[model samples]
Target: MAPENSNTEEVVVGEEVGRVRLITLNRPRQLNVISSQVVSLVAGFLEKWEKDDDAHLIIIKAVGRAFSAGGDLKMFYAGKTDDSCLEVVYRMYWLCYHIHTYKKTAVALVNGIAMGGGAAMAVPLKFTVVTEKTIFAVPEATIGLHTDCSFSYILPRLPGHLGEYLALTGARLNGKEMIAIGLATHFVPSEKLDELEKRLVSLNSGDEVAIKAVIEEFSLEVQPDEESIVHKLSIINKCFGEESVEEIIKSFEAEASREGNAWIASVLKGLKRSSPTGLKITLRSIREGRKQTLSECLKKEFRLTMNQLRSVISGDVYEGIRALNIDKDNSPKWNPASLNEVSSEKVDRVFQPFEAELELNIPPEGDAYRWSGKYENSVYPTLKGKQ
Candidate 1:
């Protein structure tokens, strides 16, 4: 049913799909950039739908030009440097945490671009679908920020050194590329997307084997295109696996000098422009993520995100928001005063826990982690063919 009232929330709509309940992202105008309002709407709906006996399966998708342009930068920009900023960030983190452990067969339809915080919405589902036009990326570094939410959990699980490359460089990919990297399960042509979705829903609508067979049909035939980024896996692992951010930068510099490659040149420039705090923390996050369990990584991310909020107002984050969103100025004066000055101590702080209690703002009523320790080993799966 179409919206009939002005009372619809900017972020969501709740409707029935046969016995399934579909929670759709509704902010088409903003490309569904998330805010606290959006977060609350999603969390609230999922929480409710999880309990609804009528909901046979959950279908999560977005309606927009781009599935989501990411967390609303304009809203984040408006609240920058204030306590409200931390509160907003906290709320978002809480939302992702809720969705991550949700027990149902939640699916994300990547009907368009999925990047940054928007990428957060797609990667945690039971299965994620991408249309031919779907473009995926994590361009957080370009705007002087780190990838937050539980992205750190999913990215490392992707096929190879691709996660590291994608995180640092903010390279975008189409649906076929996402499928290649194990980031997406199915790729349907945009015109055939609706029909494909109905078929998927049908297989899973009742019979388990039928569902598995349909999944196998999609999963069975993965095409190995000659032009895939698989060849660059060697370069990505070597550069991203260096000792520190400085070493990584040095590696990129060396690569650009030797190869004179356009990609390396862009990476070097992107590294220079990224938030120092974001870069250091990301390096640490990915490194720590290798050994960290899903629960540990989520807790660690919360710990890190909380600290990033309270350390100081007008901190590196401020300069990040200012340069990227406020002034429209690509130039940001990253503190520690200098690249050399951004010490190990400063980097350490991002990993350190915040003061006082470790209270999560979102109530832990039905968190999937609260139920079982099944997935709770300290170490996660490692990337194959990459050290």
Candidate 2:
């Protein structure tokens, strides 16, 4: 292993078990939320570890109430400039890509909350060990937007209409629900999470085969029941298929009206509660994700978030944050108060990256959407609604 660097910000790293390298996020006060510095440190450590002969596997866990709360909002607030957000988004994109494609198996020991970008990073790992306290979500919908990264690629593939369901509501996935819904690979008592990690490290042959064997034999794997999928498939598939956000909302409302489906009704409530501008942009972003490669998606997200922060152009981001986070009003004074009031100009504005010279680390002349070796269902659904 490379000698420890005293100045490194990546907290801790060392071979925990034969070849399992442990990466514990260190910013406990912020619940280990990733910052610009953390990103650089993570990039350096991951790159070095990937090249080192001593590191065979990597396990990412945190030493706080959350695995990570996601990106540092403070950084965003400090970086009101267009370039500030760009650099931050670039760091996130590269860090996530490194994690997803790492040659060694990566495990996420999600002890508590993992939401938005945090969930994005954890979901792609080979094994996500969740404890009873673990909760996962993408609450960007509540903030008047959708998540970037590969959430588009991973969420819909989840059990039932869980992806879209969570997408619309900003609802959280509890540990039990996460496991039952095919999100968590293993579920254990919250108190035993550390012990379980130790056990995992102790095992010999800690390769994929060994990991799978332990996960199957010891952990209570709450596999998603296919019946749940079939039940919601009809509504989700059709609703998700709608061409626009307006159409999808109308479809959801109409479906609820006609059948009194509790799920659809609840989703409709959430739709009504969200920022119209955010919802429209989110729809566009999801559609963009279906076609773009990973890097392209993140680049698109970077531009989208920058557009979102255009305080001079609109009241969406500031008002949304103030209402949702500052005052906890939960009722934002949106620039365009109604969904019908949201215009094509507003929707289009959110995706327009300000700079002309911005570039992405697109793979050399190849399709960017190229997902590494497929697991099962990685494709974004074309026939949508809830499915």
Candidate 3:
């Protein structure tokens, strides 16, 4: 292991126990943020294990209250135009691509907060386990950043307008909700995770059935929290499912005025607090993502991310990073000031394809969606309106 400093061990640790190869994120103090060192270690381990004849399965876990908070925002805070930060972004995209097309049976035991880049790591795995302690979100838009790490490909596939709702509002979902939303394969209490890991490590076969059977032995049925926003499916679809952000907010306001619903009021507050430009671009990203392949989405997202970092049109990303992280002010002066100030032309520019050298490259096998439909029935049916 390469030691970067006296205080920090290698941020990622790889170990072989029986037939299973274990990859653990080791940075707990910083909430296991993805730094360049972590990326290098993960890439190395994945490469070595892929070629190892004895490795039958790959399991990823973390040692912290957060699986990972996201990419190291501090890196970008230095300057988005910094070449070093750009390199990390490119490496992160490749890592997401690798996880999607991994040859081994990939399982992730996700506990605690998994947002943005962390969710990217967990969501594409062949099997993902979560505990009640797990909380997941894609809050990029809230920080004036669009979602990346192949989320463009994954989010649009979620039921109804849930994906759009999440991208726009940065909603959080607990572990049970993760399974309900098809983001995780199994649910086990946090206390049982150790026992589950032992059982998983004992499995010697590559047969998916055997692997699933082992996982199921530790899995249990879990109900979402009583106050889950997902319970408001009709309202969510009615508002978020609309054609445009302005239309959706107007619908919410109209419904709130008629019915006096507190939830709608709260959602409106969140929308108003977020960066207008971020919301407009995020909506466009998820909508266009509906028709794009994973590879195509990643390529498109790469361009968008580069532009976001460069702060070409608006410096909202820089302003956001300052307010949320560096300054800790909780106040951002979003350029253009309001949603009405953003134009479709500006959003279109963010989605434009990148030049040849800047585009993300994926392996031939990574071009297709490889999901096995295991969690297809997870989402509950949407409420039908009265005739």
Clashes of each: 0, 14, 0
Off by over 4 Å in 2: 1-18, 81-83, 156-162, 180-182, 204-206, 223-233, 258-260, 263-266, 311-315, 352-356, 362-387
For model 1, the superposed segments whose C-alpha errors exceed 4 Å read 1-9, 199-228, 311-314, 359-387
Q: Which 10-residue window of candidate 3 scores lowest in summed lDDT?
A: 378-387
Q: After superposition, how far is residue 24 of candidate 1 from its true place, in Å?
A: 1.2
lDDT score at residue 10, model 3, on the 0-100 scale: 65
Best lDDT goes to which candidate?
A: 3
The local lDDT score (0 to 100) that residue 112 gets in candidate 2 is 90
Instruction: Evaluate residue 333 in candidate 1 and report its C-alpha lDDT on the 0 to 100 scale.
Output: 83
Error of 1 at 45 (Å): 1.4
Q: How do these models rank on TM-score, best leading?
A: 3, 1, 2
Tell me the lDDT of model 1 at 5: 36
| Higher-scoring candidate on TM-score, 1 or 2 | 1
